[model samples]
Target: MYWTNYHGHSNYCDGTHLLEEYIKCAISQNVKAYGFSSHAPLPFLTNWAMPYEHLVLYFKEISELKQKYAGKIQIYTGLEQDYVADFNLIHKEWIDLPQLDYIVGSVHFVDRFEDGRYWEIDNTTEVFKEGLQGIFNGDVSQAIQRYYALTREMVQEQKPPIVGHLDKIKIHNRHEHFFDESASWYQEAIEQTLQTIAQSNAIVEINTRGVYKKKSKETYPSHWIIKRMYELDIPVTINSDAHHPEEVTREFITTAQVLKDIGYKTLRVLWNDQWQDFSFDEKGMDLK
Candidate 1:
């Protein structure tokens, strides 16, 4: 049994270690396929994203690593691109570069700040509160709604192969401090977003970043949400969202079991140069 993870990071962005370190760790963990998904380069002020100047170097190094590790593991290139639609910030077209194997479209920046910086919902809880008070005037419902709205908009516009970390805005709602996840409005927002995803060819990734990082007790979409996705017949892929070598498959053991319990018999995986559904167990996917 071997793991298949595509959403990961490296020193090019916010992640630790060089690109090759992650590959070595993946091999040690019995991983058969992996992808380098550094945070896509941004046009505006942000410290975490890869610099626009680094794109060529990132691609070149990955190309070299792909050839070096060809027979040992399946390596692919992808980026976690954020969908920004703030007119307040000057718009710049995304730079064209060598083709990527896939893209994990995500909504990290909900909206821009008054000074023109973007509000990252995935950042420190302090930043979230600041944005909530300053932007939404403390209206959690409105804030959550806007997040989902942007998510749906990104899906419609980009139609990326993978929709990353659905419902990640809930990361700050721990202990129900802000609002109830079971609230009618919250579920409605999720339902509406799922409807949009259902119509598209995009696959929803069951992200384990929140779980292993201790940010949440459940995966990005949570268990009930994955069940909802199953009802809609939305395909899913399990991703570690690894930022470190040791975290490559951090919570996959339990996540896979939870998925199976939720009636997911197969997972979407990129294998043999194609994304296909394959049978899997808690240990790992059956690539045989």
Candidate 2:
């Protein structure tokens, strides 16, 4: 396929593959480009993040892979930086690092009022239902309000090259609890978020991490979000959010076809400090 993946994980983080193995997966799929946007070194987030000590070797290995695989496949060095409550305290210096070809800024935790701490809230109905207990001591709507606020801050402050899974909060709540899917408030929150992204000139990745997780057949942002993106004329890209080689460019043809059906002619690729659109063919990935 003439597609490029911008979000993927490697053994450096919580992923299961090494940089080289991931590359082989991409080449087998015949993807035009592959990017290693593994979770960046988060000193505070020790559980699921890469360590700062590995930063030197991280770049070294990817740089070597990039050179060795040049012309065979376009490789990018990138990171998925989380939007912590105290952004400055955790990310400022790390983002300034030299090897990062791009960054996918994401918000995975929602502020919880139970212990006055941030909790990992993924919008699964069970989790959302349980999460309600800690959100302002059972204020579900308030939780949504604050989650949207964090989304705004992620866009405004981080100014990430791409917004990772804009509506990822709904990943777990698909068929159970609908987050006002037909409500004006929900629509407005999304519209305002899209306006901010468009204004910033950033891309929103169609992350397929959930698909592999069996959470849904959809990616982050889902079908509703993708359709809305078409209305706003926002730019988009596809990422497996791969943690293993088998996931490299996983469901890429399906994702690309879905985008094409929704009026997207191409996906955005970052190169030389700007986005370049790569056109798609109608017959899907030739893989010849």
Winning model by lDDT: 1
Clashes of 1: 0
TM-score versus the correct structure, for each prediction: 0.95, 0.89
Give Cα distance to truth, residue 123, candidate 2, Å.
9.1
lDDT of 2 by residue, 119-234 (tens): 77763466676777756567755776677788788888888888988877766565666466567877777778888777877889988777777777677777877888878888
Clashes of each: 0, 2
> In model 1, what are the clashing residue pairs, if there are any?
none
TM-score of 2: 0.89
Query: Would you list the C-alpha lDDT of every candidate in the order shown?
Result: 0.88, 0.77
Top-scoring candidate (TM-score) = 1
lDDT of 2: 0.77
